[model samples]
Target: MADNILRIAIQKSGRLSEDSLKLIKECGIRFDNGAGKLKTNATNFPAEILFLRDDDIPGYVEDGVAHLGIVGENVSEESARDVDTVHKLGFSRCRLSIGVLREHDYQGVSDLQGKSIATTYPRLLGQYLEANGVNAAIHEISGSVEIAPSIGLADAVCDIVSSGSTLLSNGLKEVETIFRSEAVMIASKHLSDTQKTLLDQLLFRIKSVQAAKN
Candidate 1:
């Protein structure tokens, strides 16, 4: 029974989670997502939803633990997981950017040469730097990347920018955009025939829902 159902992984909480659930509901899938519930089954669809950390969703999908996942492009690319990006949900859009102290007389990406940049997205930052011919040192940190420059941990920071309010509050200014990200649907490369059919149906409904918005 459960073996034949499609498993979808989503963030347990946050704006991404809210948007993901809303999209699911718009697709006519009903499910109970009560507080503290980690997993739920859709009442009228052949799907089960697994609530998890945003970062873990990619890995779960890659491992086939969850046949599909709704994750931000940032986390998906950062994880470097082996998964197929099935669709772009068009919500939760943001950019990975490099920021430096507001008063640093910043010029351009070349200004990052030989400087240390703190970020949670080292792989993306490293790649961007390599492509730009910048030789900055990447300081990978789990959190508080915005405060790195203020505290002297790094000369600049590479992190997600939404409203840029966080960077303004931290006395930093955006210098370069390394990546643009949005909510995206990712799927395991390996899927059973039944699961594939269910996924196709779900994608159709999702597209219809998105289309109705425009």
Candidate 2:
């Protein structure tokens, strides 16, 4: 590893990981990921890849552990870490939404009052509920939030809905969308001059690829 290498953090797995690597390849960068390595050196670029959780990417970037990161807007917002959105990757599109059992007599947002809502994104969900004047009890669950209602853990659940299959399988219906999100490129506040130059180059390539999609 070089002393001044630009480390870019990306999701180790899940929807954003594939596209993140694909975009790097399309941009003419080559990296080798043989097995379960945490960090991989790019063969054709002046950057190193750090495979990390999407939710933790923003914090890594903000703390200067990573020079840049690829993460979903939802995770970035939910993390509330100090970082800059360099580009919207236009992939892994989803919405943070409030959901309840299909049989629940959900009329509108008002029906959520005094209800227990389970969610991974408590901060964002809380903000949305507060703005809507709904006094819902938020139950913070790390994952499987959709199952909360069915298991009697909560009256409803707030979570990210992509194709809505998870909600459908769990017998939940989306009632309110708190935020629309997609994967994005994020940068830390601190960067050396050489790293900044490299970042600019990477951003240019990303922009070119993004434009080609449109």
Off by over 4 Å in 2: 1-3
Per-candidate TM-scores read: 0.98, 0.97
For candidate 2, write residues 36-115 as lDDT tens digits: 89899888778899999888899899999999999999999999999999888889999999899999888999998898
Worst 10 residues of 2 by lDDT: 1-10
- Check candidate 1 and list the clashing pairs: none
User: How does residue 99 of candidate 1 score in lDDT?
Assistant: 91
For residues 75-175, write the lDDT of model 1, one tens digit per residue: 99999999999999999999999999999998788988999999999999999999999998999999889999998999999999999999999999998
For model 1, what is the alpha-carbon lDDT of residue 78?
Answer: 96
Among the numbered candidates, top TM-score falls to 1
lDDT of 2 at 189: 92
